[model samples]
Target: MNENSSCCTPEDSRHSGGTDVQVGEVTTTYKITGMTCGHCEGAVSSEIGEISGVSSVQAVASTGLVTVVSKAPLDEEAVRAAVDEAGYELVGQGV
Candidate 1:
């Protein structure tokens, strides 16, 4: 998360082994509130994409589910902030 860190790229920052990396194709699902339509989904997706570690984000408005794929591990605070910045609340998280 350092400003000058060259590890900003998805490939560079990803955790390769051990407890630091959860193992497998790790992904987290977050329940987002206030996403009533595709526009809301787009807003959420855009915000999540700005996070350095995130590889991809898919927001489903019907389910209000945000699935984030990060080449590197992601922090809980980063997830929360992305959702919050998109004008949504993260109601839950699952590994």
Candidate 2:
């Protein structure tokens, strides 16, 4: 084995970052804060879309709700990071 090789390595972490989504797959909903317009929704959607497994994203600024569809369950932190990248805050799953 390589001197730097381990059971779980940085390579594994990098490769398993995003989970891919499929049609009619798993759906998850999250609550967000600081969204107040269509542009906000679009920004959030676009950022979350970059995640690997994400297939669809719908964000409602008025309701502060975001829905995501994916092939497998996503890492909450990843979702939070995407939202942060879009300049928003993830309040966590549900509503």
Candidate 3:
């Protein structure tokens, strides 16, 4: 692929009925359950960071939020799997 080529086509850029926006980078927030401390946050962030294309991950246990910034929109199932691997439950995208 050329440098100008995007991993996702225009149609693939939008997820869950256009809720996710991809412009150079995509930032998606996922709600999680069972995160009650800093250790939980670190585990979740580390797991999600291992996913391909993920640039950064910030997990806040206080709010049970895991914000992932990536080069492209990520597959929800993959995210859920990461959370599961971190010993947490992915409650889907945040509202």
Candidate 4:
């Protein structure tokens, strides 16, 4: 079997809109500072999505929440770096 076959079965793919299943993936939510608009959200999302192993990112300026999906838990330092690159501050992990 292919390396990814064990991660998800055909039925699982059907439920996810036919997207490839990410096995062993983890999700994290972080509180971000200085985001005030859609542009800010896009910037933060773009920066975080560029990190290795990151599969998806969602940033909400109104809530100051940034959710990240990746193959594993990301290093705090790495997240800080991405936030910094986007001209923002990583306040901390979300509650």
In the range 11-45, model 3's lDDT, one tens digit per residue, is 11111223354579988889998877666666777
* Candidate ordering by TM-score (highest first): 4, 3, 2, 1
**lDDT for each residue of candidate 2 in 1-95, tens digit (9 for 90 to 100):** 11211232111111122446556688899998877766677777887888998777878777999888877888999999988877788899974
Cα lDDT over the full model 3: 0.72
> What's each prediction's TM-score?
0.69, 0.74, 0.75, 0.76
lDDT to native, each model: 0.67, 0.73, 0.72, 0.73
TM-score of 1: 0.69
Candidate 1: RMSD to truth: 10.9
Clashes of each: 1, 3, 0, 0
Stretches of candidate 2 off by over 4 Å are 1-24
lDDT score at residue 4, model 2, on the 0-100 scale: 19
- For model 4, the run of ten residues with the poorest summed lDDT: 7-16
Task: Assess candidate 2 and give its TM-score to the true structure.
Answer: 0.74
Highest TM-score scorer: 4
Error of 4 at 6 (Å): 45
Q: How far out, in Å, is residue 90 in model 1?
A: 0.6
